[model samples]
Target: MENSLEFAQQLDRTDPLQSFRKRFYIPERNGKPLIYFCGNSLGLQPQTARLALDQELVIWQQHGVEGWFEGENPWLSIHQRCKKPLAQIAGANPSEVCPMNNLTVNLHLLLTSFYQPTPNRSRILTIGGDFPSDQYALESHIRNRGLNPDETLLEVFPRPNEHTWRTEDILTAIEQHQNSLALVLMSGLHYYTGQVFDMAAIAQKAHEIGVPVGFDLAHAVGNVPLKLHDWGVDFAFWCSYKYLNSGPGGVSGVFIHEKHHGSNLPRLAGWWGYDEARRFEMTKGFVPMPGADGWQLSTPPVLAMAVHEAALAITAEAGMEELRRKSELLTGFLADGLQETATVEIITPPNTAERGCQLSLRIKTGGKTVFNHLTGQGIIGDWREPDCIRLAPVPLYNTFEEVWRVGQAFADFTS
Candidate 1:
């Protein structure tokens, strides 16, 4: 636990998951791998991703349209390859998970089905500062449903100057709005602050008030431990490009609790979601396939699915419990080291359970210069607007040494 290079090297040498770092292609500067602490924005490319895409290309060239039903991993069932891994990652039954669509697309589609408001309870309650897309989707969807955004969209903000929301404050807000609330939509993890919301508690309180609850797990999915099914979450969606290590714009994953599978809940349907047994019939009515797959709105994207499937396989192998264990140690190590640097203000919560691997630092003076200094040293992290540097030490590919070097970079910086 010492803030020393020797200790950091010792931790890396003993990490059981040490070899997993070699599984991805790290970006380079001056022929050396950069300390890439940006998994929150996008993960490094998995070594297997290219080969997976090539296999699909070969199938496309060799079998043409027949590839849908032919080949070892047929295009028709391409989505199935990702199911088992996604299920393991999301803590859901395979039938309840589907890796499809972009994150925002799934958010809108899920909202279309889940955001049914009645006159007595017409409002949607959400965190005040969720990701911009989620904010837009809720506002526009409310308006499209003929509800006034100003009246029907309720938001809960942090108390006064606080950077993160308190669990009690969130629970109180839910109870205050319960009588008028129809749905609770929130991000499992706050993207900007790197705070992990108390999802289980939030879901419980929402349901107790007879409201449906859903989470946008863009930052929480692979970065934290999630038991979506057991937690009684009604629905959720996430992008795979971040912690899942899929290439940019990779297929996103969706989760619908098994309890909703048989219900006649309205969904935006397409031929892909048609009952698998009778898909070719192209019947007049849209009979959705059982479980989360029923929400699909378009045909499978095989090329994207290939890379996604490959990336998820590696995650499944590494396992969330192991990844999270390493993540806590990795993130804590850096946080501890920063205590020696007096000028940096950490906005992310200090509790281990309340955050993943990300540390959102607010530099007191010349923040941008400090960021530039780190970047010049080949220690690459991202700079967020206003004034904050978001650094995520991904356990899958990032080493403890990298985390230590970042601390050293901060220690040596003058600005």
Candidate 2:
């Protein structure tokens, strides 16, 4: 691969997914789209999102309360309609997926059922430097059970001077604490370093130790391929606002393995999770809807679900395998270009399978200065605390030309 503008243009010319870029509303500066490499943060809005929202609004205005059963897409089963697509993205049976509460809320709900702790097996094993919200949620959950976080929460961190956790170390920690470990919760992809964890291997190890495993896939879903059902994961949760492109603070999704669907696992149930067929009967006892739908709480937000439906449709049409193929090429191209530049270290794993679209650059010096320069020049990457810049060349909307331009900006700043 030549480090030339023509090379970038050629790659763009040959990219099968290049046309998908037009489906998004990229931010502009002086009539040109900014080089957006922050899909790992908030994704750009889809072009069809407004139409999707307007359709729901129209249904609301015309049908009023009758909208529940009186529209092309009925509100009563709006979330049920999302299950199949969401399941496709999660690699689960449609019965095993549900779009409902926000990410952390869903986490707590799943934990309520899965994180049953006894006197001996009471500790939760998780990786260190997880998203702050997860850390807080775990601590709160432990505290609610009259347990101390310091004693009940076991966190694994990277070795000295390392940016990501090793698979061996993670397995070792799980083995060492198997007696006390009640649940294993980890992120499918590390948010800061963009390293993809070996979720299947971890799940196998946790199951071997008689502990259930779950994943916080906030940064993984829609950014990479997942097989939660086949991996035998107990449960998982993720947000749609980032790589899923469902708007800011969009509705989140959850997955429960088919094996757990009809079992007598105790869940924090609500009216919505009640059996849909018998829900209107107003029965005294709770009969949970089979599968992940049993975990849903409140009524689905129609407007947000409208946006999610539109976004997931786009992802479905593009297909995850194709998206991942382009993602690997796009990120690899960026990595190669960044290596030729100076003053920044690529901290993400070089192996394509060990990462998704994001690259974490550890700036050698003047980190904020370089970031500001790139921002002023209309390069849209995010800056993490201390000294990292996270950039993601999202395959659905980003082009090779954009990757090349970001590389050139880094070269200019470092030069």
TM per candidate comes to: 0.99, 0.99
- For model 1, the stretches where C-alpha displacement exceeds 4 angstroms are none
lDDT of 2 by residue, 1-415 (tens): 6777899999999989989999999999999879899999999999999999999999999999999988577999899888878888889999999999899999999889999899999999999989999999899989999999999999999999988889999999999999999999989999999999999999999999999999999999998999999999999999999999999999999999999886888788899999999998988998888888989898999999999999999998898999999999999999988896678899999999999999999998899999999999999999998999999999999988888888888888777
Q: List the residue pairs that clash in candidate 1.
A: none
Per-residue lDDT for 1-415 in model 1, tens only?
8988899999999998999989999999779999999999999999998899899899889999999999677898989989999999999899999999999999999998899999899899888978999999999999998889989888899999899999999899899988899999999999999999999999999999999999999999999999999999999999999999888998898999999999988888988999989999867988889999999988888999999999999999999999999999998999998987887989999999999989999888888988999999998889987789999999999998988898988988843
Model 2, residue 216: distance off in Å is 0.4
What is the C-alpha local distance difference test score of each model? Answer: 0.92, 0.93
What lDDT is obtained when candidate 1 is compared to the true structure? 0.92
Runs in model 2 lying further than 4 Å from the true structure = none
What TM-score does candidate 2 reach? 0.99
Q: How many clashes would you count in candidate 1?
A: 0
Task: Please give the RMSD to the true structure for each candidate, in Å.
Answer: 0.9, 0.9
Report lDDT (Cα) of residue 234, candidate 1.
Answer: 98
